[model samples]
Target: MSRVVWGACLLVASTAFVACADSGQTAAVARLASGEVAVSGTPEGIPAHAPARFEFGTEASATRVAMWDIDVRPDGEGLPPGSGSVAQGREVYNVYCVACHGPTGMEGPNDRLVDSEQWDDVPSTRTVGNYWPHATTLYDYIRKAMPQLTPGILSDDQVYAVIAYILWMNEIVPEDTVLDAETLPAVVMPARDKFVVDDRVGGTGPVR
Candidate 1:
């Protein structure tokens, strides 16, 4: 019995059938051995088989894994041990955050994060003060990604401080309030009730 195997060759797409001629046609063969089957010319090498194993990259190190796994949950599960006041947060915000977000959270070159209560009466842009439902999410987001130019550079206390400043500007917290793991999650945003629960039934169960 004879076995047929398609060679890894460039396939030609044509509608009409053309017979092999001496002009310029080359036939691709799966197996090529000395003094064996010859098409336009004699075979060059032996049969090529698929590779059994493939080697690409190395395993990730523990340090690298820890760096990427830095997400904080809504329940303040991953919060670090640190605290900051609104005053301290304002200083950090003026120094690092003001360049993009402007002097106050309302005066923004980017999205406004404060003075957004007017949105309740009129159709306005969604700022953190009016749209966000949780305070802990703010701390998590800023700590993971902020300072746009240089993210993940701020210390835990600095992250808490900057978050406090934003919250104070939004009127969600007192100016003298300090933000930490315990206090951050306890903050209830004004729009919390406005957001409806996700009750969509997925293929498996309820998405909620």
Candidate 2:
């Protein structure tokens, strides 16, 4: 064959091969709009049967799962079916809270937020009896999230029991009383009316 004809034949074959290769590529594989290689079916390497959504799966199990994690709120929401007395609370306090909060509920290693003394110059002054506006905050902070190292470990009954004990020690409630949502909210902490509204904006200003 002539050299020119041979070169032309080779060029035609290469062009045809390139065209065939280009035709095989996917059209919507990687679109300009999405910037994703949109998968019409199951994505590469992912099994079709696998969950694309969250599921432990099935209706009965789903209800159980939801019920398992029901949240109890601060206003007597997740209060378990239990009751506690100041007597019981004293026992709980001795075991769980006393070392740091003290048996008398005074400030110990931790900030005593129950019945701590009032001093005009004393910094870090807050006790459950003297400072907390609502006793439910004590139950909520303790039960939902205390002990400094561990929180939310106490049962509802135990938390109420401890709170009752703290109140007794603080002198707001009698030693024989039981604490619950109804009674706790009504206890009327000494500082409840004493605390003035704070409306301040910056550094080293007068407190109202």
Question: What TM-score does candidate 1 reach?
Answer: 0.62
lDDT of 1 at 175: 88
Q: After aligning candidate 1 to the native by TM-score, how far in Å is the CA of 193 from where it should be?
A: 1.9
lDDT for 154 (candidate 2): 79
**lDDT (10s digit) by residue, model 2, range 63-100:** 67555643433244444566678999888888888888
lDDT score for candidate 2 against the true structure: 0.65
Error of 1 at 152 (Å): 1.1
User: Model 1 lDDT vs. the true structure?
Assistant: 0.70
Q: Write the per-residue lDDT of candidate 1 for residues 52-72, one digit (tens) a residue.
A: 334567878878876776766
Error of 2 at 143 (Å): 0.5
Superposition error at 101 for model 1 (Å): 0.9
lDDT of each: 0.70, 0.65
